[model samples]
Target: MNLYQQAEYWLSAHKIDQLPEDEGIEVAFAGRSNAGKSSAINVITAQRSLARTSKTPGRTQQIIFFKLDESRRLVDLPGYGFAKVPLAVKQHWQKTLERYLQTRRSLRGLILMMDVRHPLTEFDQEMLNWCKLSNMPVHILLTKADKLSRGKGSAALEQVRSELSGEMSVQLFSALKRVGVDEARKRLNEWFQITG
Candidate 1:
């Protein structure tokens, strides 16, 4: 089976203490609320409901894990920068996320999703900066490409590329149109050391 088909929901963790033992490679998906992170996961995995997508932003409140096999997994992190959530909950998320990013031994890389029209927000930059400090690899997906003209989308991609320096990779993606799915799969496979 393909890597996507091998994915199965494994567990969810609301607190750092609840996380599974660090033993395998894990690539995490992260973004601001309503940035289409879940939708992108669904599209990439070819599992329409594997990661729940909601019209209401900030619905995902925990770190969700999907096992690809015994030693490879995908992590869906809680969406940050939601205004409506209570301050206490937001603080908890901030702490949990920071701890995970700083200490998770199995984490191989991060897939940072951003909407095509609104590529970088303050929170996105914060995430990028943290990854930079930690020397972690990040792949930015400019999602919702169907919302823009092809020329505009390409221009946005170029602009983001020029703005970022280092090992980061950026791509245009559209869950609606299935753009960049293969490239995403290839990167994920490489990160997880999955072989055909």
Candidate 2:
């Protein structure tokens, strides 16, 4: 069976304590607002509504969890770097994300989604910084690849890989055309050591 075919609902947490017991490995997905993180998750899971997509940027405000089989979980952290959001709310998300990254031991890795056109932003760097500081593994998925030409996509992929300095893997993706969907799924399963 496909690795993601066994996915099931886990739990969503508004706070760290509210998270379920750390019995399984976790792989978190995060990106800047409007970066297509939700779309990428939905594509990988083959479940259209597993992760809510929005035309509006920064719609996710919580650390949502979706279990992939019994040994692994997919985490959807709130998108960062949305300037128009209220200052209070942004600060809250920052604090919450910081705390989780600093303390969540069950976190096995991170799927740092980025727009293929605009690979990494300041907020993206901030998130990467946290991952670096904590020594967590990260894999970047360059979303919206279909929007770019074949040549452009290749160049963009190389640009991001070279510019970012971390122990993170990277891949180009397009949920619209389903490009790199299988590769991304395979990589995630390999990273988490998930097998049927």
Candidate 3:
């Protein structure tokens, strides 16, 4: 069986204190609402419903954890910038995300997702800046690449690649097409210290 096929629903944390113990390797997924974050997670785990993809944006309202093992996990951060969600709820999640990212000791890296057609929105730039300041490694997925033609997808990838700083990496990905899945998995394995 695939390694990530073992992923199980761990817990959901509305507050940083509600998260699991801080001893394990934790890699987080962050993105603007509707950026295909859930889809990417499901694809990465090779489980169709692992992250709860939705027709409606902002469905992920808390920090959801998937335990890959006793010492490794994947985190689904609350999607941001969904205008339909209440301001109070959005503010609460913002504070929680800020605190978690700043203080989580075991967090080794972030997998950031952006829609291929709309890479690097304002909120995405904010996240990139914050991660940079904290010296966290980030690998971005330009998701929904299947939405565009091959030439357009490559162009989009190059454009976003040019904008990133040295420590960050970006790639074209389509969960639907399984594009770049291996590349993304390689990065995740690096962060988790998984080796053959």
Q: Highest lDDT: which candidate?
A: 1
* Deviation (Å) of 112 in candidate 2: 0.3
The model with the greater TM-score, 2 or 3, is: 3
Instruction: Show how many residue pairs clash in every candidate, following the order shown.
Output: 0, 0, 0
lDDT of 1 by residue, 1-196 (tens): 6978778999999999999999989999999999998999898888989999999999789999999888889999989999999999999999999999999999999999999999889999998888888889999999999999999999999988987867689999999999999989888888988676
lDDT of 3 at 91: 88
> Which of candidates 1 and 3 is the stronger one according to lDDT?
1
lDDT by residue (1-196, candidate 2, tens digit) is 5667656766778877787777668888888888888888888989888888899998787888888776778888888889899999888888888888777778888899999998777877887777778788888999999899999999989988886666777889998999998878877877788564
Per-residue lDDT of 39-130 in model 3, one digit per residue for the tens? 88898899999898887999898899999989999999888899998888888988998999999999999999999998889999999998
Question: What is the alpha-carbon lDDT of model 1 when measured against the actual structure?
Answer: 0.92
Give model 3's TM-score versus the native structure: 0.97
TM-score of each: 0.97, 0.93, 0.97
lDDT order of candidates, top first: 1, 3, 2
Candidate 1: 10-residue stretch with minimal lDDT: 187-196
User: Candidate 3: lDDT over CA atoms?
Assistant: 0.90
